[model samples]
Target: MAKGKEVRLTIVLECTTCVRNGGNVNKASTGISRYITQKNRHNTPNRLELRKFCPYCYKHTIHGEIKK
Candidate 1:
């Protein structure tokens, strides 16, 4: 019941637009637009990026991985 490390890791994806404008999910000024998902550390050593929907923006935008 032991292992070196987990292959999959939890990551947070935030909207690039909001991030640029210093908008965070916790901040009440804007609702929120982030996705919590798992990723394979081995497969994706680099930062991950995805197109997700942002209610604040009311459209799809690029969500990039940020420092945890």
Candidate 2:
């Protein structure tokens, strides 16, 4: 017998604004924010984009899926 493929997949999300400015590697008032989450491969085939709070940015911004 065979088993089905994985339905849930883990993904990484990063702040768009911070990345645009450049990689804020230093620990200061600003830096790139990343989040770890899971998604259903079948339900949403496209990349996931979510609105989340960026502590570094001091506001909410769009967090797009990034490669591992």
Top candidate when judged by TM-score against the true structure? 2
Clashes per model (N, Cα, C within 3 A): 0, 0
Per-residue lDDT of model 1, residues 1-68, tens digit only: 35648889889998998877777544556755789999999999999999999887778999998777
Lowest lDDT 10-residue stretch of candidate 2? 22-31
- Evaluate residue 14 in candidate 1 and report its C-alpha lDDT on the 0 to 100 scale: 86
Q: Which RMSD values do the candidates have, in order? A: 3.5, 3.0
The true-structure Cα RMSD of candidate 2 reads: 3.0
Superposed Cα deviation of residue 37, candidate 2 (Å):
0.5
> What tens digits encode model 2's per-residue C-alpha lDDT throughout 14-67?
999889988563467756899999999999999999999988888899999999
Instruction: Give the distance in Å from residue 22's predicted Cα in candidate 2 to where it truly belongs.
Output: 0.7
Pairs of residues at least 3 apart in sequence or in different chains that clash in candidate 1: none
* TM-score per candidate, chains pooled: 0.78, 0.83
Q: Per-model C-alpha lDDT, please?
A: 0.83, 0.88
Question: Against the true structure, whose lDDT is highest?
Answer: 2
